[model samples]
Target: MLSFLEGHTSEVCACAWSPAGSILASGSGDSMARIWTIADVMSRSSLQNEHSSVVVLKHVKGKTNEKNKDVTTLDWNKFCSAPPASYPSGMGCASCGHVKFKAGSARHGVFRVEGRLLATGSYDGQARIWSTNGKLKSILNKHKGPIFSLKWSKKGDYILTGSVYKTAIVWDVKAEEWKQQFEFHSGPILDVDWRNNVSFATSSSDNMIYVCKFGESHPIKTFSGHQKVVLLFLFSFSSGKKGDMWVSAKHYFVWAKLTVSNGTPTGSLLASCSDDITAKIWSMKQDKYVHDLREHAKEIYTIRWSPTGPGTNNPNKQLLLASASFDTTVKLWDVDQGRLICSLNGHRGPVYSVAFGPNGEYLVSGSLDKSMHIWSLKECKIVKTYPGSGGIFEVCWNKEGNKIAASFADNTVCVLDFRM
Candidate 1:
């Protein structure tokens, strides 16, 4: 089954599934974040009568029809489960408590895992926390330039914001204040991700990645090798065992595992990809790269580690890495062997995003060609194809792996039901 969500007046840049997979939130250039209720879609017997409800959470103030207040990025609170329909007021906002940020666009917004608080970073050089129901909780008024990226710790105790000012700040969630600020990057900070509750990593346009921990005055580990700006990175610690870490950075994608012995972090594994047409895997223990994957003909846009393999959700499946690129292809790499598994060649335009299903049996890729493809890992072929009306920016699968959501440049979001 397929459904098109049309409400945003401009491009829909970001969309995230609720932790429970009952709701989907999409951010748009229209300066609005919309919560869509899709619980009934799965039970409906007929596609002809399909209907879902949406709650528009306006990010702008005053004018009902405002412009330039683009909601650039948004993430759902990982710990929250109740949808907007369960809220008493159906997503109403408090007029007085909300802070009216400057007209600059909001670059990133994320929800803490424990509390229902949502943290949003803007070009106005400020970050604001909002309740899931649209009430402003607190305002983080620091940073000297636009915030390019922000992330909430898995424990939900701290929030990290990276800015073009070449600094990254860790904010105390409960205290609603800045705990520590790190001025380590020589260029604008592009992305930030938490490695653990207290330690995290940051990437910068200066072609470097820094790993820092709480209460530390400087970065504990500095990774330098990417020839171009590092766009983004993620730290995945799915395996409860020590010495298992996965990290990725744009232009460079790094998968690293922090080896812990008696509670002390010993070493890590890092993987990075770049516009230089190469992807390299580094070993923190050896302090050098162990594998260099050079197969793509164009600049790689994004890469993701599969949620399967050892220490992951599906331990029976081999660990794989998927990378999308401007060459209009998606390549899967064996993490253990550091070799190409297969190349998915279908899209006509540059592929922008790729995501693995929670079970790791399938992979999905979205491309600027205005299409999305769902491929079976075992068969290594496209099992399903979805044509879109606009260029696709992002694609993601819900936790249940039953629904896939894609954001497009045409100011719309599409959801594909994949129960079969």
Candidate 2:
């Protein structure tokens, strides 16, 4: 731990790591959010505390606030992943300007992947964009209620936002206008995720999941088969499956379950988890279980593959799979070997999210026990931990793997500087 960040006069509500790991932005009950820089944290000379041996990470950026409303949540623009220009490939919004806008209450914030624009949603019933340096960009005023979720396209050309108004909107960034809006949800939309640049999936309080595409007035596919939110869906005959939670005759559809996902665009391979107490990777070639990832003694609830997989981001990338189980362990697997590489243990409760850093050098997991662990794949050990906080709802790494963000029950967000 660098010195404990102490500026949030209240429970921190939400935090997000920038697209690059240089900055960590956290929101709190104080109606404030602060951005901290990793370079500033690392460059400081070490000094011993008068009271204890633990090193404290100091906050370089002061508390950032708007309107004295509890900051709710935020996200990083994950779209600008173009390797590198003249500078480094992954430094995020910290390099932009610094300006804050007063709003009703911030519900979420996201940076453009190119690290040029930032968007924030507030209870004021608006979504806004700004320059990376915090200069005001534009205000997207359409949703009549608070915006809860936002996702930028991989191409960085479009933005998606879901709101409490039972609607989701897609905005065209280049034109500075909203191109399409979805209002079919019977209740407030709870979450929105992009399947690709052109298609997305939305889950609503109406107990439905809809697959929508750009410019479509109606959903291309609607899923009403689950009693609860389905985090991910997988299809494959190449890997393995055991539980009867779901079954499909051909391809394109399968049983959906809790956390764990990452799919190729062509649907050549699929990975998913279920109540069957197993982690299975199914493929198109065999249409059955190819490798049964087993080790956790309890139900495996979450799984995630390295974003830079064999066919996607990295051409020569090593295929890796990670799974979090009720057994209080996070296991890393060598997909090619069909073997469990190692298991990480430290959390005292069910793990909620398991994410692989974009570079595939580290893996992070958050749990109900209010702890976040960063494990080094090279060392196969728990490297650092941001101990003790409200139960974490989710954890994610920026594209460069330099920083991380976690959402908590305390209504706070914590961003930690990571070195892997």
Candidate 3:
């Protein structure tokens, strides 16, 4: 590790590398988010470091003794420019202006794809929008229960929030109002992801997934099969152009460009894992799953698709799916063949997170064993391992893939210089 960040007073639950990969953002149980500047340290020749700049973002109002003030999640916007002049009124707030947060902790934070605005959901049944520089922009106050997950559309025009009230709301970013509200989930919504700008999919504690569009009162499509609570969902595309893709709940969803003989687009595929110890791939054209991955002995915690294959940054590499499990192993899958390519068995504890480098040549996995391993995809072996002071909650590779930022249970964040 190049340096350790120690300002947070509690466990750091989440961390995200900025799109440019120069800045690192972390959310902690201390009711605060921190922006750490590490570009200078990364440029130095020496591996060891201590001094670095940090910006502390307080999420609570004036001093209080309330509990559960943690910042549960964090995300960085891809764009950094100011919003256009035609944006809705009352959407711009000063960077230093203080916005009061009620009696609950912030559960999730996501940035608009355009990169200028951030939206955060809290347990107080509200979602707040903020500028990139940490200004309060607007407050969304419609959900009656605590929010659990949220996401911004790819077009940067809308924000989707899922709440414990069993409802999901689509907020119009430009208009600063909710565009539509869907209340079809029978249980608390755990996670959500946008398949396109107009439609999205939601996973709930009811073991069901629903795909909803902007104006539709009912789900366009529903997926059910998991016998346990669905925790997270993601959409992966097959090509560079916008095309049909799949959505999965709890584990992950893989989307690929489906085309017909005439070159027109068809629907996409979806892959999902669950507490049931299996990850299944689904087809949009049919009701049955395409593949059922059942090698894990315990619950699968997370899944990530490699940024490779056709149309990605690493076009020459094969596209693969990675699943991290409580079974203390990370498995790489050949999504097209519906088979396991290799099993990463270096970590001694349950793997909590796995991330592929931007170049898609290496993969990083962090575990409860307090160790992070960097594996060479081609060799299917660990090339480097870094032991941490605490169990790691999350790990992410910067855009350049030369730096990695990890959040830990020890109330600290570590930035590892990968080039070393």
Measured by TM-score, how close is model 2 to the native structure? 0.63
Candidate 3 whole-model C-alpha lDDT, 0 to 1:
0.72
Between the candidate structures 2 and 3, which one is better when assessed by lDDT? 3
Off by over 4 Å in 3: 42-51, 64-67, 79-114, 239-267
Q: Compared with the true structure, what per-residue lDDT tens digits does model 3 show for residues 323-376?
A: 999999999988677799999999889999999998888999999999999999
Winning model by TM-score: 3
What is candidate 1's lDDT per residue for 132-232, written digit by digit as tens?
Answer: 56666777878987777777765556788888899999998678899999999999987777666778778888878888999899888777766876775
Tell me the alpha-carbon RMSD of every candidate. Answer: 8.5, 10.5, 7.8
- Candidate 2 regions exceeding 4 Å error are 1-3, 40-70, 78-113, 174-176, 231-303, 313-344, 376-386, 402-420
Once fitted onto the true fold, the runs of candidate 1 whose alpha carbons sit more than 4 angstroms away are 42-50, 63-68, 79-117, 238-247, 251-269
Report the lDDT tens digits of candidate 2 across residue range 1-420.
332444555666455566544556665556444554544353222222221121112211265334434444455555543322423322332433222222342512322333445566665556666544455566677888767667666656677888878999998866778989998888777566665678766656564656688878898765453333333433222222222222111101222221223432332334444434555554333435556665778666666666544344553556666777677888887654668888787889988777778776788898889999888888888888776557776677777766676767665455555764
Backbone clashes counted, model 2:
31
